[model samples]
Target chain A: MSRRSFLRGCAAFGGVTALAASLAPLRELGDYTNTEQFLQKYYKELTPSDMTKVITRIEGEVERQYGIRPHVRDLKPMDGVEFVYALNLTRCIGCRKCVHACVKENNQSRSPEIQYIRVLKMPHGSMDVEKGNHNYDSKQVPEKGFFYMPIQCQQCKNPPCVKVCPVNATWQEKDGITVIDYDWCIGCRYCEAACPYWARRFNFTKPQIPKDKINPDMSYLGNRPRKQGVMEKCHFCIQRTRVGKYPACLEACPVGARKFGNILDPNSEVSYILREKRVFIQLKEEMGTSPRFFYYFDK
Target chain B: MAKLDPSAQKKSDHTANYWLGGLTAVFFSLTIFFAFNSKPHVAAQPEIPLVDKKFLDTSPWRQTYADLVKAKEDLSDYDCYACHDKAKPPRIRYDTNQKIIIPKEHANIEMSHGTHERNNICYNCHNEQNLNTLQVRDGNVVKFDNIPQLCGSCHGPTLRDWEAGAHGRTSGYWDRQLGDINRLSCANCHNPHAPDIPTREAAPGPHYLHEASSHEPSKSHR
Candidate 1:
């Protein structure tokens, strides 16, 4: 071909390629086919139309991935079923049943480092909090003056994790439960580090769950398989508890050490427990976490 | 300048043109190489085949999630570490990694279980499933794996504390609402080797050396 004609042909080819490249973002925005690659923004940034589209996409993705359709709640919290939990330190057997339940129930990655609960084992007769060790070892109960205190997300009424999230990735609902928008979280780890109880865990990698083993019973907000590099914490099993029933840890504790009920109802079991027990929360003074989880030693 | 023969003039012109073309070509080639190398390439890798033979032959396993049915069986067996090659099996990490040493004759039965035997393993209470999932019974889907039901599966009274939010850590951002959200396995906390808490060397002890007061009004000093 002549040199001038060849140059023109080359220009045409380059132009077409550039057009395709430029249109890529628009194509994704119109229809989020590549949900995995298309990272979502915080709830505050989403418009009503954007939210509708995003929610539709999320529901579709959940069905595609898990084979089960979850009822994603768009409505606000109900008034009466205010979820709550309590722990009896005296009755605790130091068995880590609760921690394991959390891993499986929350669809957590199978890593020891990501455990939600850290049972601080302190020597008997010692009031020093600094000396307590979370790394306890025992085959049976009572490692010679050591008692178990399982620590997890306190579901604080005034949650610090919600306050520190830069993107507002996490917040408390009307019922005093802290919730996280996993897609919006930037994996900053600020919330993780800020939690005095070390309750919040970050998905350092795409959570590893055996496909066949994937828990079909997952809520959009809780226990769904999470993507890599986002912060997550206990949601008090909103999918389950909001409907009624009990928590996994409460069911698993061999020593009758856990309790749960509605705090809103003065006649509920939790209200009674709080009224009768001399209870205390973890790190109450420094942070004012105002946690709903309370602990009392019966002895 | 003297008039030259046609053949000689033609040969001189060809040599000059050849040199110019060669220089231009060299410059363009270098420019193209650098420009192409600077841009990033975003491409997806091929997926792993489902068959076992293919998996075994593959040099590096691609990111394929495990089969769900097989995974349920694996969960029952507690063999999570087998496929995840990165996992180091839970070992006793302190004091030569042997059986934990608790000082004998210490008061507190909860701490002194050297003789009293405990029956439950990791799964008895933590179980094959976690509490957050939906349970369908008799054609009805029941949400919330009540702590009482699971704890009552093993320990009856513990369910009471879980509901009251008084048995576990009360400070983190996890539990307290619904009680069903708490992690279940006993291994999540209370490491099986060292039961005693770690002590800080930097901080002073709670008690300190005291000196007698000389200015006491009607006491021993007076």
Candidate 2:
């Protein structure tokens, strides 16, 4: 063989070997799950009867795995209502109560560790979010020179995650909540990249929630046990909020720093806060996301 | 030494082999036990102190104002007539320093409410003529159930915030038509004796100080 041709042959051999080596992790597809899950239709395509069947299947799976029967529902949004959250920055003592409470209520993975809320500790003299620190480890919170701000899914009026989903797995509901269909998500994580708040959490492996500790109250679009290779986020506690109850984080707050209400109602606490308090949305002007969550100070 | 018989020499060698084998087995077992029974070593935590529990417990107002109102008849706290003579108006006494001395009967109250001993007199909040009812600064009579109004007379802005649902917590339905809303009274979260919220032990952060100090979100993501 000519010397040039011999060199070309070696290059092709090395290229083939490299490509094969790169694809080696596809062997993990052995755990890719059953045909039933693969064949299931998209969330929008599922009829009410089909949804009931899916719920029954989920209930059965939960019962089989956790040894407890769960009542899961596909709760729809209410008419003439749009949700808004108002947080009092002065009252929030950097207490992580809302974070733990949200994890328990949402049935997030315990071991692999998916938490929806991240409380940032900001210095007193500065209002810049860039200066806020999430990993502050002070013994007591509101540590003399800092104010606390918890970040979560802002549930933007114009959600970027919904805009970036490749397979149409997530969408914005009527009541101003952004929801993801775990079944439809391809786990490509484009939406995770698109989020400005770092709101989306992807299950890198099978979620490891203890069976005994699993919250029995489940919802179809909300906190039903998520599988491996899916994305989940804060759905505004859809299961409770739709049923006219306060979000778990709001109920768990000791100082009542968090507030929620229908913005459509002029009499709601959120409306009054927006009207009277010195309120600002996080990254609102720069991102133009128009978040439903509002942060306000009493002074 | 005498020359040994062939069988005797063979027997001695066998006994020596058994002894070596037994020692080997014992050492192997000892190694296995240590491997399985040893505890994993953990790094020592830094010397950061935890917040004391006393700072976090605000359970004095466990009997919220609303609850006391709803269960009014059965409650003895409002029955000021039970201990004192109904005919006589209650007397307020002051020490030589002009600080009001809490009466011996009601010495359990710990007064740390206002700065520089302001709002110290009992009759400032409690009516002199009617012991059970509260008296506002403007001399308006308010029932024990309506302490918020009495408190509002002095703390005008706070009461305004509370009325608008910006001050304390309000649980139950956000949608008022769907379900009833339970607006918590001012005294529920704050102590009448000590209105200041004490510093508290925060629930744990995502990581310990060592792991967290170096962690920061990229500015590009902001």
TM-score of each: 0.53, 0.77
TM-score of chain B of each: 0.24, 0.62
Please list the residue runs of candidate 1 whose C-alpha ends up more than 4 Å from where it truly belongs after superposition: A1-56, A66-75, A111-113, A127-129, B1-222
Model 2 achieves a DockQ score of 0.15
Q: Score the docking of each candidate (DockQ).
A: 0.03, 0.15
Fnat of candidate 1: 0.03
Q: Tell me the tens digit of each residue's lDDT in model 1 across B47-103.
A: 322212221121111111123232443343334434323334222122453434333
Per-model C-alpha lDDT, please? 0.55, 0.79
Per-residue CA lDDT of model 2 for A1-299, tens digit only, reads: 96445445555555555455545546544345445667889998999998998899889878987799999999999998899999999899887778877888898876556779898888888878789978666666678988998989999989899999989999999999999988899999999999999888888766767776688888999999988889999999998899888888887777889999889989878899999888965554479888999999888
Q: What is the DockQ of candidate 1?
A: 0.03
